[model samples]
Target: MKIYKKGSLYLTEGGEMRDDLINIYKDAPAIFETIREEIGKVVVGQKAVVEQILVGILAGGHILLESNPGLGKTLLVKTIASTTGLHFSRIQCTPDLMPADITGTTLIEEVEGSKHFRFEEGPIFANIVLADEINRASPRTQSAMLEAMQEKQVTVGKNTYRLEEPFFVLATQNPIEMEGTFPLPEAQLDRFLLKVFIDYPSPEEEYQIMERYTGHAEPKVERVITRRELLSLQQLVRDVPISDDLKRAAIKAVVSSRSWEGVEYGASPRASIGLILASKARALLSGRDYVDRADLEVMARPIFRHRIILTFDSERRGVTTDQVISEIMKAI
Candidate 1:
C-alpha cells in the first residue's frame, strides 16, 4: 500500500485495481440507485440521509443517527438490512438495560452429566445491529458498545468473539435537549463514521406516507443486492482515487476546526481519515472513478459535526456545529 501524508491525514492507495474491481465500479451506480429505490418503497424521502448511511456502510464504519421522534430512523436501518440481505438485530435501549443485554451473557449448561459454561450471544452478534434510542441507555451500557463499534468484536469474560463480516452498528438517538437523554462523550461519539441528521419530509411526501401506511396493504421491498456483492463493492469503494490537492483540502478543513471561532474543541485525526474515505464512497456511489471537490464539500459537515465541541458563548448564541464546520470549509 502506498501512503500520502499531510498534517495528520494519510491516504493509503489501493494498489493495482483488478478487472473485478473495474466491473464493480462500473456497476456501482446502478446498484446504488436500485438500493435507494428499494429503500424508498418503505421510506418516503430523506435521500441525503440514505446516501450518507450507504457511505458509512461502504466504508465499513459505524453510524450515529439523530432526529426527532417519528422520523423513521429505526425503519431506515431495518430497510437497509432487509434490502442488503444482512442479518439484522435490534436492541431497544433503556435506562435499566445492562452490559450483558447488549453483549451476551455466559450461562452454565450441563452436557454428558458435566457442567460447563456456555456463552449465549447477544444482539450484537448480528451483521447489522440497531441500537434504537441509544441515549436512553446508561453510560455503563453505552461503554459496552465501544469495543464492538471500534473493533467489531465482543469480549465476554476470558473469551473473545469475532463479529461476522460486514458488521455495522447503526445507532439512533433523539436530540440531546430531549428529556431522559444522556449525552454521549466525545470519545464514544468519535467512533461513529458519520453522524446523519434525518429531517422531516415535505407535505407531499408526508401525504404519500399516510397513503401507504393507512391502507390495509403494507409497503415492502425486495432485496436489491446480495451480501457477497455488497462486500465486493465495499472493497471497491476504497479503490476509488482521490487527488492530492483535494486530500490536502480535506485535511486543512478538519485541522482548521481546532482554532475556529466558535469551536471549543476540534475534530481529531480520525475525522480527517473519515472525510477522505466517505468522499471516496460518495464518488463511487455517483459512478465516478475519482473523488471531487463536491464530494469533499458535501461530506465535511457530517464527518465533523459530532466530533467538535462549541464554546458556551456559541451555544448561548444558538450556533450549531454545522455552522462552524461550514466556516472552516469556506476558509479552506
Candidate 2:
C-alpha cells in the first residue's frame, strides 16, 4: 500500500493537496474497513455486492443494481447507508409514479398568516437513495431523474436546485424480460456509473442468513464515517494515481467493445471514465494507492455490461453481455 502524506499525489500542479487531506487518504482504509465490518453484522452474504456499493459511493457515482427479489439487495443497500451515516431515501417505482414524486414540487402552504408556494425537497435530496424496481416506472417518469443524476441538480419550474455532495442514487431493476417492466433506454442506462449484478447465496451462507434472522436479531449497525469524512474520502478516491499505460488500456477496453463481433453497439466514453474511477475506488478500498491490472480486470464487467447492446444474432446465439465482455477482457 502506498501512503501519501503532505505531498502531491500526482505530478500535476493541482496535486498539491493539504496535509489534512493527506491524513484522510492514509486513514481511508480504517474508515472503509470499519464500515465493511459494520455492514457484515447485518448482511449475511454478498461480500462482492457490498464492495461494489462502496466503490460506487466512493467514486461519487450512481449505481444500478440488478437481481431477482429476495437476494438481499435492498438489505445490502440499507446496511451500507446505515453504516456510513448518510441520509437515506427510497422510492418504489411504479407506472403511476411521476417525475415530481421523486424531485419534489412547490405547493401552497400557510406561513404565519399568508399562503405561498414553497419548494419542498424530495427523496432525491438524500446522500443515498434506493429506487426499488426502477423498471416498473414509465420512461417519462424516469426521465425526471436525468438532471439530478447527471448534473447533480434538479430543474423544477424556473429554478434549479443543486444536490448535496456525496449524493448517490442506487437503483434496482428486475430482468427486462419480466412482465410490466419498462426497459431503461440506453441514454438513461449510460448515466449510471456501473451496473452491478447480484447472484444467489451459497447453501452455507443461506443457512447462516436463516439462522441469524430467524433465530436471532441482527446486530445494530454503528456509523463508521460522518458526512464530512465521506466527502473527504470521495475526494481521496479521485486522487488515486493511474499510470498512462493503464489509462490507455481502459480506453482500449471500451473502444474495442464497439466493433467486437456478436455485438451491435459498444460503450460510450463515459464507460471509460467509469472504468478508471471505479478501478481507482477498488484500489483505494484495498489500501493501495496505485491501481493494478487486477483492479481494471475486476471492474471491466460492471463498467461494460449495461453500456453494450447485443445484436439480434448474438441474442439468438445465446450471447450474453457478460460473455461478450469476457471476450473484450481477454482481448484487452
lDDT of 1 by residue, 1-332 (tens): 23355555544475555555555656778899899999999999899999999999999889999998899999999999999999999999998999999999999999999999999999999999999999999999999999998888899999999999899999999874567778889999999999999988999999999999999998899898878888888887777788899999988998899888888999999999999999989988887878999999999988999999999999999999988887888898
Colliding residue pairs in candidate 1: none
Give the best candidate by lDDT: 1
User: lDDT per prediction?
Assistant: 0.89, 0.87
- Report the lDDT tens digits of candidate 2 across residue range 94-168: 999999999999999999999998999988898899999999999998999889999999999999999988899
| Candidate 2 Cα misplacement greater than 4 A, ranges | 1-14
Error of 1 at 78 (Å): 0.4
